[model samples]
Target: MSKASRYEWRDQQASLQERMKGFMENPGTEQLQAVLTEMHAYAAAAQDGSIDIPERFIAFS
Candidate 1:
């Protein structure tokens, strides 16, 4: 890349790194459900409005 472009990217690199660090520290709610389907955890419940997970699993996540 050109020098000017490289310098611009360098500035963004720190911001990207900090965002990644925050993600690594805590995955949050997104980690719990990977997708939107009956096969996945929440999706199955959404279809029939029935709760599926056990109380212990809630705490574990």
Candidate 2:
């Protein structure tokens, strides 16, 4: 790789490392569970035909 490409790769790797370090510091289990529960509720609603599937979700049959 050229010198410029090597520098760019180092910068990208450093940014990714920083993001990963920050993510490791806050795992947010409770928040994740709550969101999962909400998604399950939405899935149930869609199955029941009472509510439409959310626009952003691509649930596989």
Best candidate per TM-score, number?
2
Worst 10 residues of 2 by lDDT: 50-59
Query: For model 1, how big is the CA root-mean-square deviation?
Result: 18.3
Tens-digit lDDT track of model 1 for 1-61:
4556444444544444555555567776553232222134334443554433222322232
- For model 2, what is the C-alpha lDDT against the true structure? 0.53
For model 2, how does the per-residue alpha-carbon lDDT over 6-39 read when each residue is reduced to its tens digit? 5554454445455555556765775555555655
lDDT scores of the candidates, listed in order = 0.43, 0.53
Q: Give candidate 2 misplaced runs (Cα > 4 Å).
A: 29-61
Q: What is the lDDT of candidate 1?
A: 0.43
Q: Give model 1's TM-score versus the native structure.
A: 0.37
Candidate 1, residue 34: lDDT: 25
How close is each model in CA RMSD to the real structure?
Answer: 18.3, 16.2
Best by lDDT: 2
- What TM-score does each of the candidates earn? 0.37, 0.44
